[model samples]
Target: MNPKELALKAITDVFVRKDITAFDKYFSKDYKQHNPFIPNGTEALKQFLPTLPKNFKYEPGVITDHGNMVMIHGRYENWNGKNMIAVDIFKIEDGKLVEHWDVMQEEVLPSQSANGNAMFPII
Candidate 1:
């Protein structure tokens, strides 16, 4: 697979599926992840994958590849759960993931949650 495909697959198939072996095949042990949540290393991914609700699914809208790096924009949906708009950035080297960052926000309407006329910008 291409670097971009491998990177996304690592997250979707490996991390999201709680398949740690995916990391063994796709991640560097020295991987460093920068997220508002989640720790560093393969173990962080290992621990985090299971935290997501099993019904979750990501609906990708955009995937921009810049050489060894990729940026993904998507909406995460669960049938009866919260809806999330997410943006994730990934850095890959030699078909293995080395760094990752993401921002996930709950979907809210003009008068429902925050963001309707919120002061805090979506960063």
Candidate 2:
């Protein structure tokens, strides 16, 4: 599989399944994740990822590969409970995800939702 496809699969199996050991197989030990709630690094991710409610979806957009680095745009929401559009940047080093950066906002339903704009960067 291509780097992008492999990355997506890793996310699906590791994150969705809450399999911490998957990181060793699919991600680099130096993996760095920047997200709203999480601090940093794979260890932090291992701690935070499992705490989130199940069924959080990752709808990856066109994965643009800059050689080994890939930029992914996706929407992450836990069913009807909460919604957030997330921007995740993945860097593949030696075929494994070595770095990750992400940002997310609470979904804003124009009139009903409390948060302002769920879609960030309006990209």
Per-residue lDDT of model 1, residues 29-122, tens digit only: 8888798566788786677666777787766666789898888776777623877777778888877888888887776655775556621223
Best by TM-score: 1
Alpha-carbon TM-score of each model against the true structure: 0.74, 0.70
TM-score of 2: 0.70
Tens-place lDDT digits, model 2, residues 1-123? 677876777777765676787777788877776665555557776776677776676565555667777776666677347767666678887878977886666756656656654453354
Model 2, residue 1: displacement in angstroms?
Answer: 3.7
Give me the overall lDDT of model 2. 0.69
- Looking at model 2, which ten-residue stretch has the lowest summed lDDT? 114-123
lDDT of each: 0.73, 0.69
